[model samples]
Every structure is written in C-alpha cells, then in structure tokens.
Target chain A: MTEGVALLTVFVLAVFVGFEVVSKVSSTLHTPLMSGANAIHGVILVGAVIVAGTADEAGVLVVALIAVVLATLNLVGGFVVTDRMLEMFGARRPEAAAKDGAE
Target chain B: MIAVWAQVCYVVAAVCFILALKGLSSPKTARRGNLVGAFGALLAVVVTFIAYDIDNLGWILLAVAFGAVGGAMGARRVAMTAMPQLVALFNGVGGGAAALVALLELSEPARAGITRPAGFGDDGWFAYSPLAESGGHTESEILRMVDLLSTGTLTATAFTVLIGAVSFSGSTVTFLKLQELMTGRPITFPGGPIVFGAVLVAAVGLGLWAVATGSVTLAIILALVGLLAGVLLVLPVGGADVPIVISLLNAFTGLAVAAGGYVLENALLLVAGTLVGASGTILTRAMAHAMGRSVSSILFGAFKGGSTAGGGEASDRPVRSAGPDDVAIMLAYARKVIVVPGYGLAVAQAQHTIRELVDLLEKRGVEVGYAIHPVAGRMPGHMNVLLAEANIPYEQLLEMDTANGQLRTADVALVVGANDVVNPAARTSPGSPIYGMPILDADHAGAIVFLKRSMRPGFAGIENELLFDPKTTLLFGDAKASLTALVSALKSL
Candidate 1:
C-alpha cells in the first residue's frame, strides 16, 4: 500500500474504534468523557512539534511555538480537570444502588 | 534511525490512549483513565523533544514548563460550577493551536526546505517537496515535506483553518455565556440571518481566493471572517442550548485537528484526532436527542428571549402559594416523592441541600428519588455528575422514562428550580418554540410542589403551563434557601 493510503486506512479504522469505545459510557460520565476526548485531540502538539523543528523563518517558528504552548495548555488542563471531575465519580458507594431501579 | 524510534514511542502512546478511553467507560476507573491519557500525552511530548532538535529548544522548553504550570493551577483552582466554562476555554485554545499548525506548515517550505532521510522511500504517506535545491546527485534522494504543500493541499489547509476558527470563536462565546460574562439570552440583530450569511459568504469567498491566488494575507482574512461567522452562528442560540453548541464545536475542533495531522503526515495525530471527531459527533447527537431537538433546530432556533415570548399575564394568574411549613407537611405526608432538578439547581449550588432533603425523607420511610431528565444540567449527563458530587447514590437517579412511570404512582413530585424540563408546553402548546421537545412529564404526578424563585419563564423563554395546574403548589424562594426552610419545617413537624 502507498504511504498516504496507509494513513487513510488508519484514520478510517480509528473513527470506528472511537465510536465503539465511547458509545457505552454511562450517562453520568459523559462530561468527563467529552473533556477526555478534548484532551486527546490535543495531540495536535505533534504537528506543533514538527513545525517548530523544521521551520527556519522566525515568523513561522513563533507561530509554531505559540501552537506548542496552547496545545500543551489544552492537553494539561483538559486532562487535569477531567481527572478531578472523575474522582467524584470514583466512589464505590453507588454500585449497589445502581443495581436497583430508582431507589 | 530517529524516525523509527519516534514511531515506536508513538505506538506506545496510542495504546495508552485507547486504554484511557476504555477505562473511562466505568465510573470507578475514570480518574485512573484520565491519568492514562495524560501519560500518553507526556510520552508523545518526550519523544518529540528527543527526536527533533529545533533552533530555540531552550525557549520551547521554558514556554512548555510555564504552560504546564499555568494550566495545572487554573484547572485546580476552578470551582466545580465553573467547569463548563473552563472546558470551553481550554477546548477553544486547542483548536486555535491546530489552526496555527496549518499556518506554520504553510510557511515552513517557503523558508527552509524539508527533506526526509534514507529509508522513507517505502513509506506510503511520505510525499517529497518539489522545491528542494539540487545537491550532490546520488543513487537515492531525500524527500522534503515542503514540496508536498502544493495547491493540492490548499483545500486541506483551508478546511483546517475554517474548522479551527469556528471552534475557537464558538467556544469563546460558550465560555462567556457559561461564566455569565455575556447575556445568556439569545441576542439578535435586526437583519440577523442576513448578517450571518454575509460573514459566511465572505469567509468562503476569501478562502477560495487565497487558495487560488496563493495569498496568505487573504487566507488570514478568511480566518477572521470565519471567526465572525462563528460568533454570529452562536449569538442567537439560547443559553439552555449552549451544551449542544459546545458539543458541536467539540466535533469541529476534532475535525480541524485531524486536518492538521494530515498536513503534518503524523499517523498518531491522525488516529487521535479522528477518534475525537467521531466521539464528539456522537456526543453532540446524544445531547440533542436528550432534549428532543434536531441538530438543525437547536442550531437555527432564533430564541426571542423572555420579554418577547412571555409577555402574557401568566404572572398575575392566581396560583396557590404554599409556605415552607405547609410544603413540609405535604412532603412529610407523601409516601413517594420525586425530585427534578435543572440548571437553577446548579446555579444555586443546592445539590447538597437536595441530598439532605432526600435523606430526611428516606428516614421517614418515604421513598425519595431524583427524576433525571437527559438534558437537565448545562451539558449532557452534567446533572448526574453534579448530583454525584453530593454523594447521591447512582441508583436513586432515575431516567426520564422510569421517573415518569413511577410518577404515576408517586404521591408528590417536588421540582426544585426546574422550569422548562417539567413544562407541559412541549406537548400542549404547538406554537411554543419548545414544541415537540420531550419533557419530564412532571404534570403526570398526583401532586407537584414546585420550588421556584418566581413566576419567571424558563431558559427557553416560554411559560410553563404546568405551573398553573390546580394540583400544583408554588413554594417560592431561592432553591437552597427553600429547601433549607423545608428541612427545618419538616424537622419541627
């Protein structure tokens, strides 16, 4: 397979895989899940890194640097908030109640 | 050699990301799941630092350190109620970064040429830049990424810029409204659609012109226009619908990030970005479905605000007002009470009070449960999270169907600071903007005691007909204060 075709194939597969993985998330966890997904896309930092590494022009480097900082903020902040929020959901007290319908 | 090593690290990071998502499915493992995702991000960043040696590496390191500290502090300090706005802001910056990635990609080739080392010839996705200057001729040639940035890739870049601008600007509006920095009510100009249309047309027109003429200035102008269009698109949506807007913008950011991955030809970026896009699309749809709104209606509804939609004399209609003592007597006497909460509950920080009330009722042998409408809180499932913070057991939170079914036999449905969710207008009033929207059917209860601040209409600006029902009692005050009063009154009884 050609290089571009391989990437396209992976992209398509990831789309299906993502849908399958997220579809079963309980309603209560939706906010954390959305925020988690938000953080993962912060992987655009990969592109930012490539840009910062390759660009020789000061203008492009500055732009790339800005991308790196902003993407880092997104990655770090999104994950941290999601973690904090999910910690509230981590209690084991709710499981027995969850087994009953509308206790 | 470096490329191969970078790819290996990327593979490990990708596995971590997948495991992170799987862990998020169960609430018990959610925090751990977030940690796993963070580990993936850290791994990717470290790999990049090792593989790429840029000119200003020290400054990059400094900026990254500052960003990490700032982000950690901000996220840690934000109150739980302010989480929606914080997420909106963070989500916007991510999109902005992706857009910047496209710009840097465009400028890189114009400055210094990009070249791939040996062993990339068999790489399917590798495209060489055509602008490479002739060097020593050998049996093999290195491929530069800048050569691939031809007019053919302009469409991808334009798409990235457009989507990123929309997500950034739209989420900014979302943050402002959630933070109360902007009026949550829909704001409309006189020629609203026309103005929005003009901005959109200008963006598309300039974007194509930039692509055709290779004018970076026109491209930047197009991005600005796209930003204007984003604001216009969201300005007229009521605050209650902002969750749907935020969800949709999440999808937009995901797609833009995916485009950035394509521009950079990074498989990990592509996989992660596309995964987010897919999940975000599902989330947006689920949020819309919960409210019984079509995606288009939620986006296009020009909510006219409370003043215009509710000018009638529903306020003067003599509904029986019950004091806290009287409401407490009714609550104490009920065999089954169902509680319904909404955005007002969150705004008043009354979830803990509600929990106390439930405990008090349960001690008296009254079965108290929460009726959880799908779109009750600011975001989908937000109410569950909000209530969960109060340590309300998960089983007590009933979905709309189960709650409505139980309401048939319920002695009293106590609605706390909820307005539109329990409104019968969605069903009975065809002319209502929220017509055809699914509601909690609180009107089906044997008796409904509504705890509200006043006779004001809900976030949708439409009056709730259920408030006027003969069997309903209006217990007026702040939700937390009213609940506290009820607790005291019930205790005295």
Candidate 2:
C-alpha cells in the first residue's frame, strides 16, 4: 500500500476507536476526560522534536525548541492535574476526609 | 528508516491511549487510566529518541526540563476551583506547539532523507519563484518532487497550521474569560459577524493558495489570519458557555495534531491525535446537551442577537431579606434540606464551610443532599470536584434528575451562592437566555432560602424570580461567612 493510504487507514480507524471508548462516559467524568484528551494530543511533541532536531538553521532550531517546551507543559501539566483531581475520588478514607475538611 | 521495533512500540502506545480513554468512562478506574496514558507517552518519547538520530540533544533536554518544572508547579499550586482555566491554558500551549511545528515544517522537513522545499527566503517568511528554483530536473528528480509536494501532504500542512493557530488563540481567550482577566459577558461590536466572515474567507483562500503552490508566505499569512479568526470565534460566547467552547477548541487542537501527524507521516501521532479529536468532539456535544443547548446555538447564538448577555443591573424589587438566625431557624426546623451550590460558592472557597454546615444539619437530624446541576460551577461536574476535595461523600451529591425528583418533598432548598441554576425563568420564561436549561427545581421545595452576596443576576446575567417569591428568604453575605454564621446560629439554637 502507498504511504498516504496507510496513514489514512490508521486515521479512520482511530476515529472509530475514539468514539467507542468515551461514548458512554457519564457526565460526572466529562471534565477529567476532556483534560485527559488534552494531554493525549501533546503527543505532537514527537513532531516538534523531529523538526527541532533536523533544523538546519539557528532560527528554525529556536522555534522548534519553543514548541518542545510548550508540548512538555501540556503533557506534564495535563496529566498531573488530572491525577490530582482523580486522587480526590480515590482516597476517601476517614483520615483523608478529616484532613481535607480540616483545611 | 525507523526500525520495525519502534513501529510496533508506537502501536502499543496507541493502545494505551485507547485504554486510557476507556478507563475514564468510570470513576473507579480514572486515575489508573491517566497513569497508564502517561506511561504510554513516556514510552513513545523514549522510542523516538532511540530510533532517530536527533540533533541538538543538550538543548532539547534543557527545554524539556524547563517545561516539566513549570508544568508540574502550575499543576500543583492551582486551586481546585481554578481548574477550568488551567486546563484552558494547557490546551492552548499544546495547540501553540502544534502550530509552531507546522510552520517549521515549511522550512525544515524533519525526516532524515526529505529535503526542504526550494525558494525559502533568509527570514523564513517569503518564497520567490518556487517552481523555477527546481528547474533542469531529471525524470527521477521530478518524480521525487511529486512525492515531496503531494496534494495530500500539502493539504494536511494547511489544515495543521490553520486549526492549530485557531485552537491556541481560542483557548487563550477562554482562559482569559474564565480567569476574569477579560469580561465574562459576550463582547461584540457592530458588524462583528461581517468582520469575522471576511477574515475567515481570506484565511481559507490563503490556505488553498498555499496548498496549490506551496508558498511559505501564504502559509504564514494563513496562520496569522487563523489566530484572528480564533479570537473572533470565541469573543461573543458568554461566561457559562465558555467551558463548552474550551472543549470544542480542545477538539480543534486534536484535529490539528492529527493533521500534523499526517504531515510528518508518523503513525503514532496520527492515531493518538485522531483519538483525541473524536472523543473531544463527543464530549463537547454531550456537555451542550446537558446544558440544553445545541452546539451551533452555543457558538453563533450571540451573532443573531440571541440571548447571550443579560442585564447586570441589580433589581430594586423587594426581597424578603433575613438574618443568619432566621435562616438558621428555617434550616433547624426543616426535615430535609437540599443544598444548591454554584460558582459563587467556589469563588468564596466555601466548600469546606458548606461541608461543616451540612454535617451540623445532619447531626440535628436533617437529611441533606447537594443538588448538582450538570453545568454547575465553571464546567460540567466541576462542583463535584470541588465538593469531593472537601471530602463530601459521593452519595450525598445528587445529579439534576434525581435531585429534582427529591426537591418535591424536601422541606427547604438552601441555595448557597447559587442563582441561575435554581431560577424559575429557565422553566417559565421563553425569552430568558437560560430558558431551556434544566434547573435544580428549587422552586418545588416547601421553603427557599438564598445565601447571596447581592441582588445581581447570575453568570448568564438574568435575574431570578424565585428571589422575590413569597416563600423565599434571602440572607445576604459572602458564601463562606454566611455558612459559618449559620453554623454558629444553628449551634446556639
């Protein structure tokens, strides 16, 4: 198969997989789910790295490095914040609850 | 060529992302799902470094380090109430990164063997005689040109640059609106739609022209115009609908990334980006449904002079104002009380205080439940997050439908810094901006007591008729202070 058609095949199937995975998510998880999806797109860091690493000029290198920084922020901040939010749901012991309320 | 092992690993990481989204469907496994996704990201990055001969290794590592520290710090320090804005900021930066990467691709095709297209000016903005620069080519050389400048790749590049720019700027506007750095109300000028339309058409023209001729200047111009279009697309949306816009922009970024993946011809980027694009679209639609709004209405409703902004002027109509002791007595005597929390409660950081009040009420033999509107707080289910942080048990929080059912027999509906969600107009007045939004049914309770800071309208900017109802009493103060006062007053009783 040609390269373009192969990529298109992956794209089409991924769209279906995406829809099926989150289709039944309850409204309560919408916020975290959106946040998680936000982090997933940070995979663009791979493209940024490729561009930066292959850059033949100083200016291009600088711009690509900036992209790297921004992608890192998106990927790292997104997952940490989501984990913190979800942590609230998981740790509901008596001691944890008292500590949270005391603050 | 990248090794076969790397391609297989990319497939594995893609599955991890799919499982991540799947696990988020239920609260029971959400955190683990996020961790799993993080692991996938780490694996993908490691594989890329190992498989490719990347240059500027030291600089890239330093940049990654700086970004990691900044991201973790921001995530750690932000209060739970401010999470929507933080998410907007993170989404914005991701989009900005994608746009930058696409712009770089115009001058520097990243793959080892691919050559940069000819006729790039020194400043990287202009191109002169792109076709003439490649003259005197052999048959195989011409064929190589055809492969490098394929219509599909150029179209993907155009899509990436435009949509990525739009997502970046749009998310920034949402962040500003949510952070109250800009006006929460829709800001519109006369002939706003015409101006927006003109820019949008120009952007599309530039995109097509760039795709056909592979002009670097035209591509840069498209990016600039896309930024303006993004700002215009979001400036007219009111505060309550901003979260939905953020979701849509998140989806926009996802599609942009997917196109970026196509441009780069990397399977990993393609799969992950499309997954996010599809899921973010579905989530945005679901949120709009929860608010009883259509996606188009939420976006362009302001352009048609629809109900976008409400009059912010406080009404002079008399409300039966009461003191803390009176509210305490009302709560003390009630058999069952329902608490309707809103954004104001979060602004005052009153979740813990309200939790204390609920605990005291329960101790006094009053059954309590929190009525959570689907669109309450800043985003969908944001109130639940704030209350969960305050250690409120999951069972005490009731969704809109269930809470509405129980409000019928509840003795009192104590609305703490909440207005529009309990307003009677959503059910009664067709002209109201929030008319069709399903509310908490606070009007169905036996007695209604509101703890408000002022007589001003709610976030959507419409005054609530329930505040003036004969059966309603208002205790005016900050949510935290009022709840604390009520706690002391109930103790004295």
Candidate 3:
C-alpha cells in the first residue's frame, strides 16, 4: 500500500479504538474530555495552513485556508470559554489548591 | 526533511490523546490531562507547519491571523451560562466543515470519472483492480451478470454531506431551544408518525439514487431531505426528551464527520470523529436508561408534554413560608446537611452562593453535601456541571444512588431551587406518570427546607407531593437572595 493509504488506515483504526475507550468512561468526565479533545483539534489549523501554502491548485489552497481559520477558531475559542466555565464553578477547593501548590 | 518530524509529532499527539482519555476517567486529574492533551495538539500543529513545503507564506499567515481574531472575539464575549449553546454551535461548525470537505472531494475532476463496478461474484461485493492490464483486458461475463455492488468514494462523500448537514441544522435548533430563544414545546403535526416514515423512505431512496447514478446533484438533494428529516425528527420530541435528542444528534454529528474523514482519507479526522460518535452514542443510551425510556421510543417522540394533574393541584396546595432566621436556626445546629439542587438553582444562577453556603457550614463544623438527581435540570449531568463551576469538590457532589442512602441520616435536607426530583409521590403513587422514576429521598430527611420561587410543579408538570408533606417547609423568593439571607442569619447565630 501507498504511504498515504497506510497513514489513513492507522488513523482510522486509532480513532475507532479511541472511541471505544471514551465510550466506556463515566459520564462525569465527558465535558473535560471533550474540552481536551477540542483543544487538540487546533492542530488542524497548522495542517490547514500547510496544505493551503503548499497546494499549487488555487481552489484547494482556498479551501485549506478556510479550514485552517475555522479549526483555529474552534480550538482557541473552545478552550477560553471552557476555562472561564471552570472558574465560574468557583475558585479551586482548599484541598485542590493545596495539591496544586505541592505539585 | 520535516515530514519525518511531522510524522513523529502525529505519533506524540496520538499518545497524548490516549493519556488524556485515561486521565479523564477520574475527576481528580481531568484538568491536568486536558492541559497535556492541548499541548500535544499544539506541538502537532507547529511541527506540521515547520515541515510544510510552502513557497508562499503571506496568504497562509493571513488565514492564521483571521482565525486568531475570530477565536479571541468569541472567547471573550460568550458567557458560562451559554457554554452549552456555544458547544452546540461549535459542534455544528465541525460537522459543516466536514461536509464542505466532502463537497470539495466531489468537485475534483478525477472523482467524476469514477463509477460503480459492473458486478460481483457470489461474494456479492465488487473488487477493484490491483493492476491496470494494458489494452484488451478481458471482462468477466459471470461477474457482469450479478448486480451486487459496493458504494464508491463519491457515494460515501454524498452520504457524509447529507448526514453532516442534518446534524448541523438539528443541533442549532436544539441549542436554540435550550437557550430559550425558541419555545421548548414539542412541535407536532397531526400526522407526525406518517410524515417521519415518509421522510425516512425518501432519504433512503435518495441515497440509493446517488449511489447508482454517481450524481453529486442527486446527493446534494438527498442532503437537503436529510436536513429536513433531522428537524422533523427532533421537532415532536418534548422538553423531557431534549437531553436524549441532544446526545443522539451529537452522536450523529460524530458519525457524519467520521464518514467525511473516510472520504478525505484524513487519519486524525477519522480518529477524532469516531471517538466523538461512539462516546455520544453510549451517553445517549445511558440517558435513555436514566429516563426509563427506550431509544426507539425517544426517536419516535412517544413522550411530549408533562402530566396535567400535577400542575393544578400543586398550585392549590398551601405553602408555609420561612424567614432567614427560621432557616438559619434549622441549619446552624444541623449535624448533616444535604443540599438538593434542581432547575431553579440554574434559573436563579445561585451555584456560587450555594458553594459559599457549603463553605460556611463546613466552617461551623457541619457536614454539607449536595444531592444531584441524574436528570435534575435541562440536561443530563447538568447539576454536576453547574456545581463543578462553583468549585464544589467532586466528592461532595453526590449521585442519586449515594445521596439517597444518606437522606435519612441527615439533620436537614436543604433543597435549593429543586422540585420533581425530590418528590416522594413518584415512588409511592402507582397511578402517577412519574411513578417508578428514581428520585433523591429528600422527603426522608429529619427536616426539609425548600427554597423556590413558588410552589410550582417542576418541568415534568407534576406536583411534588413532598411539598405538602409535614416534614417540608417552603422558603419563597429568588434562590440567590434567600441563600444570601440564610448565610447572614447563620453567621449571626
């Protein structure tokens, strides 16, 4: 198989496994996990930018550029909003703070 | 040269995802895990940029700048109360983008020439050529006889686009309903079931047509039909089933994106999409179980408005009013206090004040814990998320199973802006609509202090028989103000 095909297969399988694992986790962890995964989606920005700059085809470049913008907005915006939510829940508990300080 | 490093970065990012998932299993380390996962993503992006073979940087830089601006604006403006709506919007955007990717694939010239294989043997699946035999390649006559076929990339792309569009539009509607921008009442037609069936059939027919003809236009039309179907499917579902619909739609979005990733041959996209799809599906099932409803029943919009009897009778029951001093006296000397939170707490935005009250009680050597019912608010796990925002310790936020066990042992059950979830009628009254539905056993507490706006029945439109019980006392007013006054009275005592 070609290198691209190999990469694609690995990614698909990994996603399937990842989904299985995430599904088993307690409901309490859903928001935090999503928040984390969303942040990681920011990587799509770099990929988009790269694809946009390298593609000789103008249409492909335009779409790639657009993807980059959307993905980045999703990434940065999602994190900031989520962090603010965490803060609203109240300042960290004394025990949590103590642990943080120790670390 | 940089491709090697980019590949390494992808590997590292994947590992981070695994670790993050592991960390998210427990609340204690969730934040740290999230941070680690984010860093991994950042590393992957940066590495990809460095390895990119680009001659022109200006346009790419411009796109990046635009994204930065948009991200900053949205992050700064949106409030915590609207976070769920914002999440829905973001999920929609993701699905939309995936659909756009599919659309772009369809526009590719090379894709237009692709056609379904003529036939297949007894296996009933088409086999693509591993090699191009030059001129005069012999076609298998037997293979041509059987019309067994496999859907090609274009057909897959079209399906992805259709499903993604539907998920996007449907999620937007759900978000609007939750934000109160749209009415929460189920929009049902006279022949709702028949309409739903017709739409389902049409959607399937369109899918088949697109596959057989390899027509992008036909696929686009199918997408529109699916989009309409999505709205129709969710419209007749009542407020009670909104949470389940949200979960189910979320799963749909994930699956759609996964299909898009397959069309685009993107590894990261596939992985992320599948993760979201699977998790959302499980959560949907769990939510259905929590509500004592089947997934099929939820889909068919079997449950809509609340029972009629509870609302009128609940308003007629006499409520005993309590002053801050009365509340303070009861709470000040309490050995164990359990706070039951409901939709009113969310409405009053009183989570912060409630957290403060918990702290004050702990300071006075009183044990305070929160009792959270599974479907306490507008969504599943709503109370936990709200309490978490107020920095309530994960341990203090007790689930119904755990909290129910401790209600009888408590000195007082201070119900803050709560209703139906604490109703004893559900367990005792066999004729009641909500009978057999598990609730927090707040009625069993030595004393119950309920702080609500009025003696209104909860979202389920059923009277909480607990309100009329001798053990219960109602403190009427805004939850925030009531809690503030109660806090001061406790301080004075």
Candidate 4:
C-alpha cells in the first residue's frame, strides 16, 4: 500500500527474475557472463557517490566516500585485468610463421 | 526535473545492461558487450551525481579523484593471467561494502526508534534481516536480543564478508597455480577430514551465538571462522579439480554478494549478485558431473585416494614412437584430421601454434576439426576459450558427443598436449576415478599421434592407459616446439 512496501516488493521481484535468467543460461558461458556483470559494479559507484554527496551525518558521509572509491576501483580494475587475460588467448605466436610456410 | 532525467538515464542503463549480457554470450561480440556495459556504468554514475542533493563539494571531489587514480593504477598494472583473482577481490569488496552499508543504516541515530513492522510479527521472515526495526526496543536491548537470534541481517552480512574474503584469497592461490607461479599439487593434511569437521562446527556454533546475542563482535568471530573454512575447503583439492573448485568458489562469492545485496536493499546489487550466484552453481554442478564426482565428495576431499600414480599396469607395455617427419608426412597426405587438446596445450600456451598447424593441414586438402572434452583443462570450456582466441572457427570446434563419432572415421587423430581425455581407462576400468567420465576415443582412429611433455600422469594422478596402447604413438616435447617441428616436416614433404 505504502511507497516503501511497493519499493520492497519490486526489488524482491527483480532479484527473482535475475536468478531465473542465470539458471537458464549454459555453464559454458560463465566466464563471459562474469566479465559482463563485473562492469555492473559501476552502479555501486553511482550509489556511493550519491550517498556521499547527500548524507548530512559525518559517519554516513565518510562511509559513502570510501564506498565510492572502492566501487570505482573494482569496476575499472576488473575490466583491465579481464581484458589483459583475454589478450593472452588472442595473441599470435612467433612460431606461427613456420606453420604458414608449411601450409 | 533532475529526478525525471535520472530515471530516464536509469532506463537507458538497464537497456545497455541487457544488450551487454546478450553480446557477451558469444565470443565474437564479447568485446563490444564489455564496452557497452562500461558506457552504461559511466552514464549511471554521471546521472546519479547530477540528481544528488549534496552541500559538501570538497569531500565529493576528493572521493572521485581518489577513486579515479586508484582504479586507473589497478587497471593498468594487473595481468590477464590474474583476471580471475581480481574478480574474486572485487567480489569481496562488493560484499564488504554491502555489509558496511547495512550496519551504518541500522546504527543511524535518526532512525533509532523505528520499530520492526508489527505485521512482520515474529513470522521468521525477518529472520534474515538482523536490523529489522523492532518497536519499543532500545538499541542495546535489540542488539542483545538479535545476538541471541543470530539469523538476522547482521549474521548474513558477517557470513558474506567472511566468505567473500576467503574466496578472494583462495582464488588468488588458484590463479598462481594456473600460471605456474605456485605448485599444482594438492595441499592436504594427514587428518584433513577431522580438522575440516571441527572448523565447520565452530563456524556454525559461532554463527548461532552471534545471532542470539546480536553481538557484532561475535559476528566478526563467525566471519573469521568462515574465512578459515574457505581456505581449508580449497587447499586439499588437487590440480585436476581446480577448475571445478574455481567454479564452486565463484558460486560462493556470488551467493555472498546476493546476501549482502539483500541486507542493503539495493535492487541492482540483488539482480547482479543473484545472476552470478545461480550461474556459478550450475557451472559447478556441470563440472562435477563431467569429472564423475559429487559436490559433497569434492568439498570433503574424499576423492584424493583414487588418484594414484602408476595405477595403469598397461603403461609398462611398449608403444610406438613417432618423429615429426613421419607424422607430418602422414598428416600432409591425410583426408581428415581431428586434434584433441588437453592441459598440456594450456601449459605450453600452444593454442596459437595449434591454430597455425590446423591452417597448414587445411591447405593440404585435409579436413581438420578440434575435439573438446567437457573437463579438458583446469576449468570447464578452457580449451574452447583458448582455441577461440586463436580465431578458430566455431564450426570446427566440436563438442565431445559430436566429435567422438567422427574420430573413428578420420585419417589421423593428432592429440596435442591432451592426456586423460583420450585415455582408454575410462572405458576399460570401472574402478578408476574417471571411469564413467566421457572421453574422446582417439584410439579408435586409423592412426593416433600423442604430443606430450612426458609420460607423467594427468590431473587424475593416474597414468594414461591410452599412452601405452599399440595404436598410439608418443611424440614427446613441449607442445609448441613439437607442433612447430611437425609443421616444418610437413612442409618438407
């Protein structure tokens, strides 16, 4: 009936829907799924920044500031690391030259 | 007016998230998906700031600057091999942040008197929400009562933080092992089971105590217990099972994040966390089935005894040895060839070389395809990702079920750095650990060429019975070097 109750109900349903999507996907896609989801940490960054800016209380403000920093690090750092790892698989080897001549 | 714009931006961000997820489902579009997700995140952050009602500009700027510098440094420095470890570390941070947020909300002085809705009324629904408002109860009194009840939000947060921290550390260890920075052997104790049982009991007991007393201190102790439990849980698992363990730990991290999300009442956190948790669980289950092991058996380290070296008596029988010249000549003239990859290919970082070798074979009018075992490397689908990176065609990368039937019809089965996946032990010995686990029948082919570093046992810690078969010929060397030599010899022919 109330706004709070409505927010809570929607939140609960969104989580359930998210779980359903995860269950239906194949296991072979796990790594890529994670790489995609890790980017979503940026949402946490947004939340942290908002909380930091708006909270009047000193304690809340301090915590929000810390959260913002951590969340940003996670978002950017995770992508960089994942990209570098993917590069290892994509790089062409020097020995490939020998195979080229042979073919 | 700002709220309206912010809502619009949120909608846009949600769309981007959906599209990013769809793109990431296939390797060809994964990079684009990553970029789209990043843009969505950037949009969400900028929009949130625009709508935020903040009076203190100084603190906000400092936080942003610090976040930017730290993030840039981490991104620039971390290696690709350590990406999974970094993921674990970030998962820990997310869970920890959620736990901290929940605690701060509960301890807020302004919201001190708000009581738990009477409608909830001991229904045990709030059992997971430790900080649920309880009417007519002082903070200290409620804390004491919650300590006694232990099943509330505090317990959930504590458990999440504890598990997340352990996953972070354990994943780092696994990354090092995979990269050859650490030994791939299983670290086990003489009485590992008893110690594991004790830790589990302590963790549960302390968790209950923290809930009953609503004591944050006790919750912290419970967290430590969980942290130790995670380390103990993973240490005894051998190299062969690392992929499954990594998948399982990924699941644990996901569940922890979801718990934290529930505590913080954040919709995005819940959505992302639940998605990761459920997927990780399914992957762990699939990997376990592929290995012919139960989840419980993996957790308790009961499968170690079956992984004996030299268990295959047939390995003593003499087998043929093939030089690169002979093998290349045969392959160059062959109509069709199927390449079976194993951990050895991964160890030598030879996927690119293999890809080149395949190209050479194709130029000779040979139909070449790859046979992928479900549990080939340290992780599920490890070979697929590696091969895909070399720009291998999806049509050529065949699953075991599809590829197995074709192996017998092929002119040659050129197994590169693979072992147990092609071993005949799975079929011949019902008593073996990998007995029922499906394998590629490389022996059934007209000719078999095994490329291996040595005669060492594979992940199961047992000698491959296929290695000694009369039909199989051993071509020993580093996979990259061996494949290169084969290419040269083929060109000479």
Q: Candidate 1 or 4, higher TM-score?
A: 1
Q: What does the interface RMSD come to for each candidate?
A: 3.8, 0.9, 4.3, 4.3
Ranking by DockQ: 2, 1, 4, 3
lDDT of 4 by residue, B1-493 (tens): 2467676776677567656665555555656766777777777767766765655668877877786677667655753233444555555454444444433433442244433332213366335544556565555645543332324454555565566556655665665666567666677778987898899888777765654444556655765676677767777766667666766766666566555554544444545455556555665676677767777777665446646645323344566888999888888888989999887886677776888789998988899999988767555655666676556777898888889988989988989888888888888897776677788999888888999777777766677777777777888899989998987887777
User: After aligning candidate 4 to the native by TM-score, how far in Å is the CA of B407 from where it should be?
Assistant: 0.6
Candidate 1's DockQ: 0.46
lDDT of 2 by residue, B1-493 (tens): 4799999999999999998999887999999999999989888988888887799988988988898899989999999989999999999999989889888776542222233344322233223314344444544434434444556777888899999999999999999999999998888889988999999999888887887667667788899998999999999888688999999999999999999988877899999999999999999999999988889998886324655434688899998999999999999889999999998899999998998899999999999999999888989988889888888999999998999998999999999888888988988998887878888999999999999999988888888899999989999999999999999999899
TM-score of predicted structure 2: 0.94
| Candidate 1, chain A: TM-score against the reference | 0.83
Q: Write one digit per residue (lDDT tens) for candidate 1, span B84-115.
A: 88888888988888888887676544343333
Q: If you assessed candidate 1 against the hidden native complex, which CAPRI class would it receive?
A: acceptable
Considering DockQ, which of the candidate structures 3 and 4 is the better prediction for this target? 4
Q: For each candidate, what TM-score against the reference?
A: 0.89, 0.94, 0.80, 0.78
Best by lDDT: 2
Off by over 4 Å in 4: A1-16, A23-28, A38-73, A80-103, B1-23, B26-36, B47-152, B290-292, B309-319
> Once model 3 is optimally superposed onto the true structure by TM-score, how far is the C-alpha of residue B465 displaced, in angstroms?
2.2
What's the residue-level lDDT of B437 in candidate 3?
68
True contacts kept of each: 0.71, 0.83, 0.38, 0.38
Q: Model 1 captures what fraction of native contacts?
A: 0.71
Q: Which ten contiguous residues of candidate 3 chain B have the minimum total lDDT?
A: B141-150
Better of 2 and 3 by TM-score: 2
